[model samples]
Target chain A: MHVIESGNVAAANGVKLARAHVVAAYPITPQTPLTEKLSEFVDAGEMDAEYIPVESEHSALSVCIAASSAGSRPFTATSANGLLYMSEQLHWAAGARLPIVMCVVNRGIGAPWTVWNDQQDAFSQRDAGWVQLFACDHQQIIDTVIQAYAIAETVSIPVMVCYDGYILSHTYMPFEIPDSDTVDGFLPAFSPEYALNPAKPCNLNTVTLPDIRPDVRGDTAPGYMEIRHNLHTDMREALNVIKTVDEKFYSIFGRGGHCFIEPYNCEDAEYIAVCIGSLSYQLRDVVDALRQDRIKIGVCGLRVYRPFPDEAIRETFKSAKGIIVLEKALSYGYEGALYADIKAALYDCDNRPFIHNYILGLGGREIKTQQLLDALRQSCTIDIPVPQWIGLKM
Target chain B: MREDIIQIRWHGRGGQGAITAAKIVASAAFSSGFAGVVMTPTFGTERRGAPVLTSLKISKHKINDLSPITEPDMVVVFDHLLLKEVDVTNGLKEGGIIMINSPRPAADYSYKGMNVFTSDINSVASSVGLPPGIINTGVIGLFAKATGLLDLEPLLQAINIEFEGRNPEKNIEAARLAYENTMIGESR
Candidate 1:
């Protein structure tokens, strides 16, 4: 069904359709509406989910961890400082291999308390084992939520569907919401391999020991090598499962494109710009206009961030003369996180295009289409600059 | 044939339904067989009474321009205060139209090189027993009178579609008052 709704409402509907059993979230700017809408759905009997209004972001994730361990499809959402507050639990969730799905309304962390669009929150958690997917538009926002459930449950890893804070969260758009039955047919019911059951009484979250060292802490425990290997393998296997679930999703929804990466007008383009979140929409128009003028320009939107699609990245930029990386987050000392990843992925490929990193739209600064076009033009002309900031006043 | 689309930029505060008004206008235009897109560059920290700019592009052809309009063929100011805070007149094409929801007459405001139409949309709304914030619908009616780009019948039909099954009568009455009270002509 087509509904004119806000991104938050769309996400809430997606979570409901995905049949999440438990949703625990603390109210934060931008992220509040999502939980609030879910609460309404719960109260109206529209969704059969337990709406847990937690005390804080930390407690929110803690409750989600507990719920997921109890064999329920658990979901939660937070942003900026909220994500920071739940940082410890994030590691716990990932290490425990809990199939928790979260909607992160990306916002800037604050000393000044800015509640605007930025990737600082999600990007800061890049090392966490959760599979991260950034959505470019409202439709993607809804679709990714459903896809996240399948991907996370398939690999027993948490997944985050990240979108710009105010850009997509608060903005209203026309979105297609699949009926509940249709969603159920697409995304099966959650059935975990292992869960916390008192009857079985299995050990969970035990201490680990160092390799080749005895009595390191006090007692011998699980090997650290084994734990690390397990986590790595779970994450690695998640990449292929994400692709498989996305293929199934495409078949059900009848929308065909790479769910992990959306390539726009890139088949024969000379210059390509890579971006995620709302900026991709702006880049799409710029590429279209440039293509009309016979300027071989294209765009690639990286939807999947965690377990980054390295092979796809290399192939996407293989033919381009130059690639511009548009990021909404900064790493301070080094280049943008995505830029570093792309550079590392293409290090072995011959004739690799100069990858210019453009940091933009931080603290919710507006990024116009002209600015994106200007950045693309600059990338085509000069050597890809290091740590270039776009739309910055100084 | 090139579609003669009328792009409008709406300036209002949050909770004022500025975005909803744009959607209703677009939906109305769509119901009239014209293609349109409604969008807003929302902020994560948007609050009540905060300045928000929403836009609507109505044309017979597909609109692929996602960029915010630097210059608009029509400007609709839902709040009087936004006029001072935002440059609603910037990039306003020649012979463009400006619709302001103010009780004061059009002659009171001085804006050269553009046609300004003024209406007491709030009073009209209150008279119809609707809230003051429904001035966006009034502004849309003024848009219809100023440009004739949309017919009132389709506009009302679109409004019914939006408010239908929920407050349909009041919305239709609000649209009618707005269509009647709008003062349309060239700016002084």
Candidate 2:
């Protein structure tokens, strides 16, 4: 159905269409509406799911872990502090290889206490063993959530679909929603290889000793090291699953999107801007305006951040004269997380561009167009400064 | 108005439906075949009677800018009292349009440097039996009639969808009353 809605509502629709059996969440500012709508769906008998209104974010994911382990499709959502609170369980969920899907409405972390948009909360958890997909708009939010379930269930991994808080969450846009039947045809029911059952009792997360032990089949069981190694290997394999699911979704829905990075008008451009999440929309405007003046500027939006689309980044920036990476989250005492990844991607490239990283719009600060324009113009010079802080009060 | 993009900023109190008005207008524009339509209500803590802001950008082509509308082609004030508390004309384009929900004549509320249009949205809402504090569609009708940015039919359609179950007829009636009763004026 074609309807005008907010990103939060679209996310709820995605969860409903997926027919998830368990939704466990603790309401945060921007994440509140998504869960509220889900609760409404459950109450209205539109979806047959148990909406667990947990008291804390930790319990939210904990409940999801229990539900997912019991051979049920589970979903949850949180942002900023709530995400941080659930960090311990995040590792547990990933380690257990649960195909749990979460929506992390990206918001500024509290120290100064802000409830607005930023990517730091999710970026800070880049090593949490969950696949992270940042959405550009409401439509992408809905589409990515559906794709996330497919990718997660197939790869035995968790997926977090993120979009900037309030910016995409509160803002209204027209999104084409897929019917439940279409979605069901695209995403099948979750059937796990290993689920906790009383009939065939199995110990999960058993303590591992220094040496490998023999299994009942006379084969050596995976140790703690091997388990970690397998997790890494599965993550690497997940990159392929992500792309294949996106292709299948496009074939069915006719709206194809880049699984990793989306490059806009970068084929014949000298200067390119790199950003993530909803901020990419603003950079596209700057690119278009500069293009009108024949500045040959382009933008590349990082869609998937966890697997870190290294090859795509290298390919997109191979011929560029300069690259400006604008990120909302920083690595404290270093540069932006995205900049670090980009630098690593092009470290061995033959034609590496003069890269500059600018951390902007932290803690919900406004990133104006004029500031970005000036930064881009300054980046064109020969002697460019790295890690230029845009719109700093100091 | 710029043919490529039309930016509008709305000034109103927290409970006056300024945000809803902006959304309805954008929905109307989108329903009228404008593929690029965005409506953003200012984020953060909001309380009733407190001043708030929202913005809308409508384009025939794709709109890439996610930034707030710093410079607006049209400025809409949901409550006349907001003009006293906030600079309702801030960043308004030269010869741009400023609309207010005032009962006075358009000429009476005209500012020094922009065209002004006035409509008694409150009266229209009251007459149509809409409860107090819901004048979004009424002012939207006045906007559609004054600027012709969106067609009246689409505006009504949007209103119908916005207030689908809660007496949509009253809201549509309020909108029609505002559309016919609105007074438009030239630049002062």
Off by over 4 Å in 2: A216-218, B1-3
**Predicted complexes: DockQ each:** 0.34, 0.58
lDDT of each: 0.82, 0.89
Give a tens-digit lDDT track for model 2, residues A1-394: 7777889999999999999999999999889999999999999999999998899999999999999999899999999999999999999999989999999999999898999888899998999999999999999999999999999999889999999998899988889999888999999998888788999987888788766799767999988888888999999899889889999999999986688888888889998999998888778777877878789988888899987778878888999998899999999988888898898999989988889999998877888888988888788765666788999998
User: What does candidate 1's lDDT look like per residue over A210-314, in tens digits?
Assistant: 663445357655477777688888787777888888888888897646866788898998988998877876687788766766789888889888888898888
Model 1 CA deviation exceeding 4 Å by range: A211-222, B1-6, B13-15, B29-36, B41-52, B57-68, B79-87, B103-110, B131-134, B161-166
lDDT tens digits, residue span B75-151, model 2: 88888888888998888988889989998888887577798999999999999999987898899888988788878
- What's the TM for model 2? 0.97
Which residue pairs does candidate 1 place in steric collision? none
